[model samples]
Target: MGFDQYHEPPEELSQKVRTFARMITSLIEEAEAIGWYEQRISVEKDPQARAIMKNAQGEEFKHFGMDLEFLLRQKQDWRAELKEILFTTGDIVKAGERGEKKVD
Candidate 1:
């Protein structure tokens, strides 16, 4: 089976790298599912159907968080940088700049 997630030759990459790539792909897929659900929910007129889509979207959000946490655990520097950038209010650009400096 072809793994489209790998940019490099799979044979040359470490097992850990392969797993990371898989999780990254999973994260992307979950984000896409969330966006698709958002669009569907926005257009749907039925309240029941919209509620179901919202529930499904919540699951996707959870999956995305799990995938991200896994990837973050694998990369400490990334975790440190994100700590500075995520879950904070005011001046997102400043937070990112601070994160960049911390990582650097």
Candidate 2:
């Protein structure tokens, strides 16, 4: 019920920008949920509760991935940068540097 996501006047922004902002908010919420579940699972001693938390955490992961894919599809440079850094087997910093080069 809060319009905290919009730093500027929402009426002045394009529909596409609004949609992007909403997705970014969703992505952040999903990430926070995932982290919360992780912490809960770590402290939870009950096996059933832990299992349920893990399952919910996995669902959050899926949502996060979907949001990321949607955002990446909207930006070719983001896709290229992620492609260079993600799923690779070398140093991550080096891969990020490579990704930056791709963006540059």
RMSD, one per candidate, in order:
0.8, 1.0
Per-residue lDDT over 33-91 for candidate 2, one digit per residue giving the tens place of the 0 to 100 score: 99999999999999999999999999999999999999998989999999998999989
- Candidate 1: worst-modelled 10 consecutive residues by lDDT: 1-10
Q: Per-model C-alpha lDDT, please?
A: 0.96, 0.95
Candidate 1 ranges beyond 4 A from true positions? none
lDDT of 2: 0.95
How do the residues 1-104 of candidate 1 rate in per-residue lDDT, one tens digit apiece? Answer: 98899889999999999999999999999999999999999999999999999999999999999999999999999999999989999899999999989989
- The prediction achieving the highest TM-score against the true structure is 1
Q: Against the true structure, whose lDDT is highest?
A: 1
Q: Let me know the TM-score candidate 1 reaches against the reference structure.
A: 0.96
The TM-score measured for candidate 2 stands at 0.96
